[model samples]
Target: MAALMIQGCGSDVGKSVLVAGLCRLFANQGLSVRPFKPQNMSNNAAVTVDGGEIGRAQALQAIACRTPASVDMNPVLLKPQSDVGAQLVVRGKMAGTWQARGYQERKAALLDVVLESFRALQAQSDLVIVEGAGSPAETNLRAGDIANMGFARAAQVPVVLVGDIDRGHVIAALVGAHAVLEPADRDMIAGFLINKFRGDPSLFDDGRAEIAARTGWADLGMAPWLAAARRLPAEDAVVLDRAGPGRARRVRIVAPMFPRIANFDDFDPLRAEPQVDFGFVPPGSPLPGDADLVILPGTKATLADLAFLRAQGWDIDLAAHVRRGGRVLGVCGGFQMLGRAISDPEGVEGPAGAAPGLGLLDVETVLTGDKVLRPTTGRLVSGAAFAGYEIHVGRTLGPDLQRPLLICDDGAGEGAVSADGRIAGAYVHGLFDRAEARAALLAQLGAASDGLDQHARVDAALDEIAAVLQQSFDIPRLAAIAGLEQRP
Candidate 1:
């Protein structure tokens, strides 16, 4: 079995997208390729085929390879709930919450499991493409690191370092990484890749050559800015509460930003709509008065983000929006926030306590240890069939549930709708992933539906990206680096 790992100089350097594109490129060549990440830290997660949760980025990579996402793809997942602490998941199940310092001390022990997972994927596939989290430049974390160089050396996998040229100082970033890394770690990097290059590639020829000359790492080649990547769901943590470029369209849809928001990609389908004006209302910004629909996205810490919402005075804005006959919809933690109350006696999200909700829906939720991680198929009350997943920790009950906004295929009611039908909440994430659901929700808002199939669009984007990589990068070098035959 052959394996290659991709590590970046820093976070948000387009590491995830590079791995995804490579996965598709290799898969298109009739080679069985699987993506692996030893560790990933993100609140955006996806339910796997085996009733587990993995980073959404890995899930996207699985799609690029046209395979089912599995927990083994991402052995260790971290969902940040605060600045200094995160909830840990081991092989797709919650392990526990740990502070930054605490996790740093204990993470070394996880290397065995990480290698075990990687070995399993290698046994099943001809080639496994691995992705690293954060950067090995932060050598301070290198003692117990399983995410980057530590894992690469242990697994004996060659590394390709990727630097984002779009962020400027590509030369410094590449050479700086070489200067800072330990001698052994430096040797693990077999080559260097420059990503997100705009303008003329020839303009940076000397710059790339300078880095190769200084560091003596093979040049894997530069990749142009991939516009096709935008079609894929957001993977970087920076995108959690990122605001959209405000442009007025026929339908105005808005979502309040939360510090610990989870699965915000739930709104990607709506944001992609041509007739929709969508943005995330940042902490200080008030919710738009003209918004036709206000969406409350899922969160990792329900009670905490509920407090964050109120501290931003979003509750008042939501109340006013509803008073103006505007629509409101909440998913997962956001759904729990729209109800009458949220109780967390076990302190699963922090100090055990309860928080009053927006009272927009007649429902009460209590945090529980039982986390729902399953793929679901159901239809909206508006007669649209949809496929989605539920990944949250809470049990909700109330009279509003009797007027469910959705009916599951198993004959179970999901979500709640207010008496006037202007307010609704659901525990499901990615409900709008399907074109049918998007059309139904758009029609309900009195907006035109383009009826674009999201699945097909993403698939096409994958193909486009694979074709781009095939032409832009030195695929022959990449193939030989993996000890595989060059492309025929």
Candidate 2:
């Protein structure tokens, strides 16, 4: 099989972004490239066109590769509900919930599913770039591990170990990984690349040779950090908590830091605008008193995160914000949280039966029956067309719906808007991804807008990263080094 595995020395080392860049890079070379992440753990997920949920990172990578997203791209997904338990998604469908021990014990039985997805991708693509999750040195977890080295070995794919130079200890981290790996696992490492290097590349000359000598792995190249990385849609679930200035404008939107935040990309377009600045306020931090608008992003566990929000005193803060005539918006779970009460009689999100919302709107939600999953297109009160998708399980209705913000084309629930014009919400996940929608919001806040072309902007950003890689990275050397036989 013509596949290459991108394994990392550790987690949070930009392996996902690197894989995305490589996917775009390879696709530009006239090769059909597909991104594969053997296993993923994140609350941030994307609905596949085929109706399965996959990690947001894999979804973004698929977009970068210019390929249609599929469950086959990410075979295993884990959405953590508690510290020790996670909801397992196998082959794009909800498998079940499992604690740590239970999951490992049962993980091996799912290898066939993983293999099936991998083989499918291999058959469809000229080149498939598989991304490993976490570090490969977790020997204790190796037996049932379908990610990292186990996946590489199972696919019989050569691996390029990527270490983050920006994290410091580059030398030790790279060599330490080699030292910890079993002899057979170490043999799969065809080469090593230093990623996110900031300073002079030549200064790391000695470190590169040292790593090669110690690990018996060839030095592929050192990649400098590309500033355009921020322009790409972040797949990492952690981006839900990423704090940054939004578009430079008079109107500001502050989003509460929900405990189990998901689909935070709903706000990316706003942040990309120079006219608006978006800030994520955590539990202890005070909300932005100057923000003209406040937003409640989506979450995995509405009841749990809502309880955590109450504990943080944000409920009081949100009330005060709305009292002062600040515009408040909610999406999906956020939409649920804006109502009078959220009833989880079935206990889908948490053990708690129900929780009170901020009550800015007169709406109340009942978490019951069936989930709503469908692509949507609708119009604002002004007749402007907007498009997004829905993935929620709750049903909400209130007097506020007398003036709906978005009128659903389908027979689904029309989203709500408060009479005083202080509160609004929709079940749609990406309402702001559209430039015109963002511009309209900015105009409502009396702020300047950029009118950006989101699709072109993302494509240009990927192209810029490819240009950076071409200039700084040693692609030919990397390909050759990645072909090396692993040391015994």
Candidate 3:
């Protein structure tokens, strides 16, 4: 079995996107390829086919490889609930919550688990493309690191360091990594690649040469800024701050950007609607009163983020919007927040207590130790078919459930709709992915949709990126680095 790991000089350096593109490129060549990340720290998660959850990036990479996503693809997932604490997941199941310092001490012991998963995947594939988290440059965390160099050394996988040229000082970032990484770790890196380059590649010709000459690392290639990448779902919340495309539209939609928001990509399909102007209401700003819809997105911590919503005065804004006859939609944790109350007697999220919800729906939720993770398909009240997944840990019950918004194929009701039909909440993520469902919802909001198919768009974006990488990168060299001969 052969493996190649892609490590970055810093966070948001496009390591995930590159790995996804390479996965597609190799898979298109009829090579059995797999994508693996030993550890991932992000709330953006995707439910696997095995009834488990992993980082959303790995799921996307699995889609790129034209395979089903599995828990083994990402064995360790950390969903941050507080500034210094996160919920640890081992092999796709909840393990426990740990503080930053506490997790650092315990991470080394998980190396065996990580290696076990890697070897399991290695046994079934011709080439396994691995993605490293954060950077190997953080020597302080190198002691028990299972994310970067530590995993690379243990797996005996060759590494290719990626530097973001769009962030400037690409030369220093690459050369600086060489200066800081230990001799053994540095030797693991077989080459370097520059990502997100704008303008002429000739501008960086000398810079690339200087790095290769100074560090003795091969220059893999330079990747240009890919507009197609924007069409794909983003894995990090930082991208939410960047302004979306400006298009003249009829309906205005605002979603509050919570600090611990998870699965925010559920709104990607809405942003693609030409008749909709979708925006994330950042902190310090009130939710726009004239908005047609206020969507409460999913979060890692429900009660804490509900408090955060009130702290930002968004609760007040939402109440006023509802008074003005604006539509409200809640998803997952957001669904729990729209209820009359939320109780966590088990302290599943935080303290064992109950908090009053927004009171839009006549329902109550009790957080429990048991989590529900499943893929589902259902139909809206209007008979529009929709498909989505459920990943939450609570049971909601109330009289409002009698007026369910969706009827699953299993003859079960899901979600609740307000008596006046202006407010709705559901535990389903990816609710608007289906064209018919999205169109039906838009029509109900007095807007017309282009009925875009999100899944197809994502597939097209993957193909586009693969084509670009094939043209710009030296495929033969990369294949050789992965211990594969170039196919004619």
Candidate 4:
């Protein structure tokens, strides 16, 4: 079994996308490839075939590899619930919640579990591409880190360091990592790759040489800015603030950027609609009065983000929007927030308490320790078939559920729609992934659909990126570094 680990200089350095592209590239070459992450901290999660949860990025990588996603792909998953605490999932099961300090000490014990999962994948696949979280330059956290060099050494996997040139200081970031890392950790990095380069790659030849000379690491090659990447789902929330394509169409859709937004990729399909103008209203910006649809996205911390929504005066704006006969849709935590009340008696997220919801739906929710993770397929009230997943930690009950928005194949109702049909909330994510469902939803807003299947679009984007990597990356050198025989 052969393995190659990709470690970035910092967060949002495109490590996930790079690993995903490589997975597709290798799989396209007829090699069995699998993606693994020792640890991942993200609210964007995907439900696995085994009824477990893993990072959404890993799910996408699994698609690239033409395999079903499993919990073994990402053994340790962290979903931040607050500034200092997060819900921990070990091997696809909820372990418990841990504070920032508490997790630091406990993570060392998880190294064995991480390696166990890695070995399992190694045994099954011809090659496994592992992704590292954050950066190893964080020497303070380096003592018990299972996310980076710690896992590299434990798994005996050779690493390729990635530096984002678009963020500038690629030289410092690459060479600086080598300087701060321990000698053994430095030895684990087999080479370095430069990512997100904009202008001429020849201009950075000297800069790349400087990094090679300074760190004594092989130069893997530079990747130009990939336009196809935007078509793929982003794992980090940092990209939410980046400007999207120009809003040329008439249908206006706005969603507030919550503090701890989770599964925001649910809107990727909406963003792809050329006739729909979708925007994520940032902090300090009021929800657009002309918006035809206002969507409240999922959040890791429902109560905290609810408070944040109110603090930003979004509640009042939402009321105004509703008063103007605009439409409102909420998913997961957002669905809980739109209810009459949200009670947290066990303090699963934070302090034990309850908060008044928007009261748009006659529903009441109580946050519980037991999480719900499942993949569902059903049709909307309009009979438009859709497939989605549910990942939440609360139970919602109310009268409005009688007018459910979706009726699953199992004969279970899944969401609530107001009497007037202007307000709706669902515990399901990826509600609009289906072309038919998306068309139905847009029909309510006087918009049209191109009948695009989101999953197919993502699959095409992966192939496009793999083609780009075929030209931009040093595949032969990378194979040598990973100790794999190069295929014709």
Counted clashes in each candidate structure: 0, 13, 0, 0
Predictions: Cα RMSD each: 1.0, 3.2, 0.9, 1.0
TM, every model:
0.99, 0.94, 0.99, 0.98
Write candidate 4's Cα lDDT for 1-488 as tens digits.
88999999999999999999999999999999999999999999999999999999999999999999999999999999888999999988899889999999889999999999999999999999999999888888898889999999988999999999998899999989999999999999999999999988899999999999999999989899988889998888989989664476869998999989999999999999988999899999999888999999999999999999999999999999999999999999999999999999999887889999999999999999999999989999999999999999999999999999999999999999999999999999998899999999999999999799999999999999999898988999999888889888
Worst 10 residues of 3 by lDDT: 240-249
Cα lDDT of model 3 overall?
A: 0.93
- Count: clashes, candidate 1: 0
Taken over the whole model, the C-alpha lDDT of each candidate is 0.91, 0.81, 0.93, 0.93
Error of 4 at 275 (Å): 0.8
Write the residue-wise lDDT of candidate 1 on 1-488 in tens digits.
Answer: 88889999999998999899999999998999999999999999999999999999999999998899999999999999888999999999999999999999999999999999999999989889999998889998899899999999999999999999988988999999999999999999889999999999999999989999999999988889999988888876476454557787889998888888888888877778988888888889899899999999999999889998888889999999999999999999889998999999999987799988999999999999889999988999888998999999999999999999889999898999999999999999888888888888998887877788778878888899888888888888888787777557
Error of 1 at 326 (Å): 0.6
Model 1 quality (TM-score): 0.99
Better of 2 and 4 by lDDT: 4
Residue 338, model 3: Cα distance from true site in angstroms:
0.6
> Any runs in candidate 4 off by more than 4 Å, and if so which?
244-246
Model 3 deviation from the true structure expressed as Cα RMSD, one decimal place = 0.9
